[model samples]
Target: MNHDNLLAPYAARSAASRGRKHEEPYKDSRPVFERDRDRIIHCAAFRRLEYKTQVFVNHEGDYYRTRLTHSLEVAQIGRGIARRLHLNEDLVEALALAHDLGHTPFGHTGEVVLNRLMADHGGFEHNRQSLRIVELLEERYPGFDGLNLAWETREGIIKHSSQYDHPGHPEDDDFEPHQRPTLEAQIIDLADEIAYNNHDIDDGLKAGYITLDELAALEIWQDMSALVSRKYPHLRGERQAYQTISHLIGHLIDDLVQTTTENLKAYHIDNLEAVRSHPDYLVRLSGETARKNKQLKAFLYRQLYRHYKVERMRIKAERFVTLLFTSYKENPTLLPRKLQQRFDEHGKERVICDYIAGMTDRSALDEYKRLYEPYERV
Candidate 1:
């Protein structure tokens, strides 16, 4: 079914997409953005997300959210917001799923080390790496290097920003860096935040890094917990925490949708052009919600992210990433023959960066053992 009739005037319709970098004849009934979402889901990089870090390392536990689960949650939340706003759900889902395609192992720690190592080699950022993965890395298409996704989808992947992601790259000039992306793209940014913020609380609780008593100090958590308690007085322990988080997510999503809708009308944004020409982002949470969200993030930064145990893991990951990059740079032959062959085309540092960036946490650890541990098998 054509989704055009259901979309708002400002929503990005697949028909009006800037189209793919390498055009191919339409071979299916799926919409352009739907096809982009499918291609992203099936790609090798998407599969690797299962082993990539989110807040916790992949092997830490079976319950914590990995990059793959985070991406899925982001997509689910994005689609919900898109549906409520009459935006293109397919495009939003595509953007949400593809947003983290470039993240390295060990969460941001791996990325930090790689950027420091490649300080003179254009540096490494997950957002830019995400764009690179879709535009150049994946080799499934016989006709193109990357997935050959829609221009809007590509723009969303590169422009995706959150507390963790800062998307500014010299190579993204072609995506109209000055203009705002579609509302669908913008939704993924906040959806990502909403997913991670709430889910991180869950993971942190599960990991014993945080406690309900500690979380109750935050106004957002206090309010949500009170509401959940009133609704389910007998609820306690993990179930109570889960209910509180569920209520918190719903509150956030409602506030975001209401605030963004008001912003659209206040700014006289009735069409895609107005969305693009608008000086500031149209998608946002209300002032109060934004402040509460900030408080929660600050709490997490201090309590969970900067916890002693997490810091220990970060330090070890930094050493692993740094040593891997240094060893590979010092010995070009250490890279697989296929990766080494690309060195002449993409430069030694960048090829090594790509190889390291594509690694899963488990793989990186295994590779470290192989390289550094004498008894470990090659």
Candidate 2:
């Protein structure tokens, strides 16, 4: 109940200060929670997220999860988990909302290309890029550099235990040791998985890329159906799909709540921050659940991600991105003056490419078309 601890979860300092975003206004009209949320919502990165890919490309159908929609879903799911667990709601919302702010266009395809192109200039990692976006990229208040977000928010974005965990501590020279992510951060990662897993299947079905029969035929889907039916026997057919996935989401939330509650209970009574810091402290899913999640991930990769049609599209996207980077470097005049300034300061071709790669699909395409086809607008 300490006020400092209450605020501690959302505090973020700049490269200048070892603290959090201070929303000092003429008058204190909004809570720090509301202010932080609004700041993230209004930032250029947040807006750009709308045009970034979640799984599908921008040229794909509109119903797929763009980065913006995915963030919104993750935020909603995270907030739900936070409310049930009595954790800090604002911190969870902020974590979920800003988690993917630094993602490159064309989903992982663009990330792969950029990482190859910029391996020397500290490489292009989205988590690190996200940290940069909030800490330095966003342009707003004059006195501040970046958003000056809460340390917890930044930690959640960069250290949330996905494959994307960036280097954090000094033990590894190539990368930082990952920060010990909080329970709220853990929930956001699970929420992201849950949100995307179910929705991507839905989108695939809608796009005619995957048939409902194909989905049901998978052993994982069959088990998922069985689990849903065992849990809620009343649902069947279309109701099964809707109700089953809903049940899965609820089940995951329940697991997270129970597991996090146990950890919090231990944390409340113990002097062993060291023990609590272990990754096992936050992992909630059972062996069965873990297996199921893996199966689903594998199924998606084999069926949706590696489909020849989708792979061809992604290959083309990689070529387009490469072309843009090559052209931009050859003729730096095509870049904005601000970008030129960055180029002069960093003096690295890959760093410049990193900046461009972090753009949304539409922005990247626009930049490409602007330079290559000056007369025609994309």
Candidate 3:
């Protein structure tokens, strides 16, 4: 089927893509963005996400979401929204799946520490790191140093924004920092918020860091909880919590689609060019929904993210990242021979930052023990 034919006029079409950095002959029937998605899925960075942190460390519990599962959820939500809006599902899915490819081992804490450590050396941010991963880090292709993803996919990865992400960087000058990314990329941003906001609630409740009574105080949660109760009176316990979260996610998606459709009309965005030329995001939730979502986020920030236990982990993660980066900086020989070879080309700090940033939570911990522990095996 010609999937492009079904996409809205404003959606990003693979045929119109700016193309990859290192050109290759078309070797398959898959569209350009689809090929980018497949490449991301097979990359080492994506595989490492399986062991990377979301809100909890990998070993915290078997039930909590990891970066891999979070990315999957974001992709699922992004594709659903794209389908409803008649946008390019492939492009949205690509952006969603590859959004967090550059996250450090211990979630935001790791990123924070790394940024602090590299404050003099251009600083560190996941969005830029993600861009680097696709453009120059992952060495899968014999012809290129990185994945050589489609320009749209690379733009989405760099421009991906959320409360946690600050996307602009000096190295991203090639991506037109002044312009808005495609609507597909914009969709990934919100889809990412929806995934983490809702899933974090589930993880927080499961971990006993936040309770239902506290959540009931938030208007968004109360509204969803009431709806879930009315719809499924027999639901109780964790099942009820799950149902409420499910309903909340559905409500958010529905509101986003409706509001974004209204925005497209309001802003006169009828084509891909219009989307990019627009002054602000064409994809967004309604004002009321945004306010409610903000409230929910604030609640999570105070109740879940700031919980004593999570803070303790954050502190430890900071220490681990700081120590690791410092050790690698002081003793460049400690890095694997492969990483050491890149020191001449990429500089020592950046090469070390890249190596440490790519670590999974467990691997970072294991590496720390091997380097510092007297009896631990290297």
Candidate 4:
């Protein structure tokens, strides 16, 4: 039942100083996990979030939900859920904050295009890319390439997907599926859903892409506005919208926490440590709530995600990625020597594709323009 064992590795640094040396600063301060949260907050990738999309392109407006705002919202919601469930607030906040550090520009468009380009080279998954960003891309330390984050944080980053349901041993090829996430990671998944579900609506409305009436007409949405009013009677307009969502998220978190705690008790599961570490572990929902969630998911799919305008943009992104990937592979001279070295080692088009997947949206666009529309740039 002790919590220390679950958290000790994160508290200790991976490397120990050999020097006769420097004393640790600040006699007693926040734990290393807390420090990790702060580190992610200040990283360049975190800052670029402002320019990245979250359901809509950043160019759409100054007020829409960019990646930074979404991350903040997720962190806030995750922390709220964690505190209510008696989980570690810092761990949840850290995981929430770092969850999307590896997202490419232009949202999922960039992700899909990159994945297709790199499909042969182990393919590119955003979750894996996030891991690569923290572990290998960020060059802060001398001895190691990545931030050398704690095992718990790294595991959460890699395996936070809801599909995790495998054994929890190291030797497994897919350690993520087998490994159970800490309670923090569980909060993050729910928090991410809470954030995007509501925020995307906000963005769509602002962009003239959808309207309140249209949202209200959906069968699942009926009376929800009135429910929102009852839950947040004092707020108005956007504030009301935000509070209404916060209320729904709160209800879900309460239900989840209570159900999970009761389930553990009923089963006489004495693994308090395990239960506490994985507050967000997957659990079957009531058919009613499950159906409601699916309905909302469907509404999003039909109305927001599959609109013709979005499809056209996504198609353009696909073409841009494909064209550039093809050009770079045929004439490796166009790419930086560093990337070309990887191409040489792998000696496959897929290896070259992996190189392209790592580029930022702006970087990809620049490469595309450089190759396709040389005079247009002028």
Prediction 4 TM-score vs. true: 0.80
Q: Which segments of candidate 3 are over 4 A away from where they belong? A: none
Q: Per-residue error at 342 for model 4, in Å? A: 4.5
lDDT of each: 0.93, 0.70, 0.92, 0.65
Report the C-alpha lDDT of model 1 over 69-137, residue by residue, as the tens digit. Answer: 999999999999999999999999999999999999999999888999989999999999998999899
TM-score of 3: 0.98
State the local distance difference test value for candidate 4. Answer: 0.65
Candidate 2 lDDT, 30-149, residue by residue in tens: 444445567788888898888998778777777788999989988988888877765567767877888888888988888788878776666777777787788887889778877877
Worst 10 residues of 1 by lDDT: 161-170
Global fold similarity of model 1 (TM-score): 0.99
Q: Per the 3 Å backbone cut-off, how many clashing residue pairs does candidate 2 have?
A: 16
Q: Is candidate 3 or candidate 4 better by lDDT?
A: 3
lDDT of 4 by residue, 37-127 (tens): 8768877677777777777666556888878899999898887766665566777888888888877777787777777667666666677
Candidate 3 residue-wise lDDT, 38-130, digit = tens? 999999999999999999899999999999999999999999999999999989988998999999999999998888888999999999999
TM-score of each: 0.99, 0.84, 0.98, 0.80
